[model samples]
Target: MEEERLVTQVTPKSEDFSRWYLDLIRRTELADYAPMKGMMVIRPYGYAIWENIQRLLDERIKASGHVNAYFPLFIPEGFLRKEMEHLQGFAPEVAWVTQGGADELEERLAVRPTSEAIIGFMYSKWVKSWRDLPVLINQWANVVRWEKVTRPFLRTTEFLWQEGHTVHETYDEAQAETLRILDMYRQFVETELAIPVLYGRKTEQEKFAGALATYAIEALMSDGKALQMGTSHNLGQHFARVFNIRFEDHNQSLQYAWQTSWGVSTRLIGALVMAHGDDSGLVFPPAVAPFQVVIIPISIGNWKENTLPRAVELRSRLERVGIRVFLDDRSEYTPGWKFSEWEMRGVPLRLEIGPRDVKNNQAVAVRRDNKEKLIVSLDGVEAKIKGILDGIQASLFDKALAFQKENTCQVSSYQEFKSVIENKRGFVQAFWCGSEECEARIKEETMATIRVIPLEEEKNQKGKCIFCQKEAGTLAVFARSY
Candidate 1:
């Protein structure tokens, strides 16, 4: 039997958000540091959450006219070099496989940081006519980017992600697909993961390398830091032109196909933990929680025989209604211990069935978020669980939205923006001059960078540039990011 643990063992988030994040990850068995620097071994519990996210996201991807496909992980060095800008951007982090078993290879193969190089080459061969224009395919795979600094799932040397690559006949069609997938990503995170994001276009300095435009969903963590949730890029003809990904138009003229690539990585799990987790541990939204409900059978006297059977029955009922549940029937641990463990694991709902509760034909229901206890009658318990889970999902997104709103504010002066970036940190909305020189100078002076140019209502508001006193180019969100 394991020794009993105190809930307060996990670091308080307010005390130190980073330490608290690592503590909760270990406590919940989400991920652990690997011997290799900047690498992580995702525990089964963490992978389960990712699996649920994949299931939900894959469904949406298929519904939106995209299919799954896989490509080579090792790209020839020359392939990455084909696109000069793309090669330059990832050159610093590219891991090269120089040897093949015994003899030294003539050409080093790059472990793909992203598959655009090799994938675009394949598309060049596969696409011959306009009929093959819209190749909407997504691949769920792992990519390696040698990171000097790493954080568990957030910025690992290697991480699992889904990369979507598509080709279109015209610029307009490709641009539309880019935004379409962007909206899909936003909907998935907000509705399924229950993490609200700020949707906007990336500045030239921040956009993906070699991309004509890049759009992202930026989310604010509870610690007043911003995290890039996901990104969609309109590649235009950059890769297609470099790789000869051309197709014969209806007029029989060879034209370069417009392309797009977008992805969201395991870093999302870190975002979820940071956004919704409390001092106790992780608090997952019901949709992605490995176990939405945990059943604890109170073990006192012969309640094992009494409470265990009812707990099993409740698990069966909840499972029948599509609720992911775990029944803690282990006799070694006390019910209180199980409750605390599951609470730390962030099960949205806890149903405790004891001798008294079974006798009273009710179960003690506890919510993980607020730790609210309710005496739920045994009748229609499945429906009640479903409703509560739905409510929990909504409440999580709303709470995160409220937190983002509370932390975010518009600043008019460079002095005020610098102060917020240094002393107080959240999202500071400020005007930008749309100059790369200005952006770099600001980032060098203040660790905060322009997260995204707001495309919503604030983009229309006119104001002077926060730094240079020039005309406003666009409204931008500035923050130090993970």
Candidate 2:
């Protein structure tokens, strides 16, 4: 018991957060450094969490009329070059495939940093009329980009994600589709992942290459930094014109189609860890937790013989109610050891069934988020666990929303903006002049960029740029991002 207790006290919150994150990931067997620099291996435990995310998001995408499809992992050099802006945007990080077996390939193939060009080329070939409009397709794949620095699930040389590509006949249709997907992503992150987000449009300078407009969902992390949780782009006619994707109109004239693309990567998992995890380790929301409950049977001396049956029965009962439950029946580890282990893994709820509690017809239920425990009667343990899971999910979202509100600040002067960014470290809501020069100057001085310009314009109060003091155009949220 003494040795087991020491393991739980290995690291505390007052220490460095980065070190705490590294220790949590390692100790919980979530991930490991790969042989290559700036790359990581997601262990089974971590992958299980990712699997849950994938399952939930995929269902939502499918329900929204998007069909799953696949495209080539490697794109020809000329294909990427077709869209000059996109080539320039992604050129810095692209990983080229030059050799095949022992022979050097004639034209270097670029492992897709994104599938826009490849998918656009296919759309050009497949769609010849308005009937082929709105080719809604999604693909789940891995992409590679060489990076100077990387964190486990945050930034990596290679990462897994789902990308959605859709084509529409009219500009209005395409623009509406772009916003719709952005809202979908926002809903998924907020409802399913239990993280609150700020949704708005990206400035022209920060918009995706080959896109006329870009929309994003940004979430504030516990470290006072921002993470671009997801993005949806309106490609306009750029790709359609480049790929010669034109359709004959009802009036018998040919016109270019409008396109849109969007994606959310595994970086979201990283956001979850940074936003909600603590020194005690991860605290997952019930919606995404792989195992909603873990049952640990506590025994000392002869209590083991009597406690085992009750724990087994409880596990069976929970499973019957369609709850994901794991029974830790390992005799080698103490009940206290199991508690810390599951807590590190971020199991939503934990049930401890000891000899004393079994006799009392109750089990102690603990929540991972608050570490609060309550005695729940075994008579309706299934329903009780379900209610606790729902409560944890709501509580996690409420806590994140509160943090966002606390960190967010409104500044009217340049000095105030700098102070808020440096000290508070979150979204600085202020008026912008809508000039690229002012945006560039702010970035140069503060290393903070305009994160989003809200769709709903503020009336009457706008006067001047917070930095340049020129006539202001709209309210923008600026932040230093991950």
Write down the lDDT of every candidate, Cα atoms only: 0.91, 0.89
List model 1 lDDT by residue over 349-396, tens digit each.
Answer: 999988889999999999998888999999998898899889999999
Model 1 scores a TM of 0.97
Can you write out model 2's per-residue Cα lDDT over 44-94, one digit (the tens) per residue? 878888898899999989999999999999999998999999999999999
Residue 66 shift from truth in candidate 2, angstroms: 0.4
Query: Which segments of model 2 are wrong by more than 4 Å?
Result: 1-14, 458-461
Best candidate, TM-score: 1
Where does candidate 1 stray beyond 4 Å?
A: 1-5, 457-459
Q: Can you give the TM-score per candidate against the true fold?
A: 0.97, 0.96
